[model samples]
Target: DAGVTQSPTHLIKTRGQQVTLRCSPKSGHDTVSWYQQALGQGPQFIFQYYEEEERQRGNFPDRFSGHQFPNYSSELNVNALLLGDSALYLCASSFGTAVQYFGPGTRLTVT
Candidate 1:
């Protein structure tokens, strides 16, 4: 019955560094999606994981990756980070195409 939760409410890293953010989905959920939101901009879908497989992806490059566990938890990993990568990383959980519950989001700052 828990809601979506994301770890490391905030993070700071220099360009070229790598970062990993974690997320735990709400109970009875089987899908997890990741997104990036820049200041003054709407979120851009990164990808979605279900049944431990990536089902869909956005226009982002290969540097953005994610994984979903059997228990429905997920992790997002970004490599070769760029300053432009700084933004809010949000995780959303839902069952099928039903309405999703989003996490508070992890603010990532790239220097």
Candidate 2:
């Protein structure tokens, strides 16, 4: 019955570094979605995964990628990170197309 969870509540990295964020889906949930939220801005869809396949993607470059495991857990990977990438990364889980519940989010800061 646990809700979605994300790791490394806060992170700081220099430009060009690579980062990996993790998430665990809520109980009985099989879909995971990722989002990026900048300061004073709403979250922007990054992508979504269902049945371990990337079902849809947002307007991000290839540098942004993700994977959902058999257990429904997921990870977000960003390569050659830029200062502009600094933002709060959120993980949301849902059952099929049902309502999604989000995690606390991981705050990433690129310097």
Candidate 3:
């Protein structure tokens, strides 16, 4: 049984550019949550989607958006990227409020 997975393990972008990160949840999971982790800091919740709807969101700005597909996969989009946006984006999947399983994360560098 494969766990959650993310794509483009590493990415480089420039300020003012836009980027989209993809994630696939583990089998049997229906909820996906996205987080941003800065160097030497704990992960900060970005948002979460369930049933194709945004169930919750964190303190992130509107530039951060997400979508959850019927198949339980999700995507995170960040627009007008800033150097501060450079961090490890993580995807965690869970089953109806259960424990979440996280992916290796996507490292984004905004220069």
- Candidate 1 minimal-lDDT segment of 10 residues: 93-102
1-111, model 3: which lDDT tens digit per residue? 999999989999999999999999999999999999999999999999999999999999999999999899999999999999999999999998899999999999999
The candidate that achieves the highest TM-score relative to the unseen native structure: 3
Error of 3 at 4 (Å): 0.3
Off by over 4 Å in 2: none
* Model 3 root mean square deviation, Cα atoms: 0.4
lDDT of 2 by residue, 1-111 (tens): 678899989999999999999999999999999999999999999999999999999999999999999999999999999999999999999999899999999999999
For candidate 2, the 10 contiguous residues with the lowest summed lDDT are 1-10
Give residue 55's error in model 2 in angstroms. Answer: 0.3
Return the TM-score for candidate 2, rounded to 2 decimals: 0.98
The TM-score-based order of candidates, best leading, equals 3, 2, 1
Once model 1 is optimally superposed onto the true structure by TM-score, how far is the C-alpha of residue 73 displaced, in angstroms?
A: 0.5
**lDDT scores in order:** 0.95, 0.97, 0.97
**Alpha-carbon RMSD to native, per candidate:** 0.7, 0.5, 0.4
Better of 1 and 2 by lDDT: 2
lDDT of 1 by residue, 1-111 (tens): 679999999999999999999999998899999999999999999999989999999999999999999998999999999999999999999997688889999999999
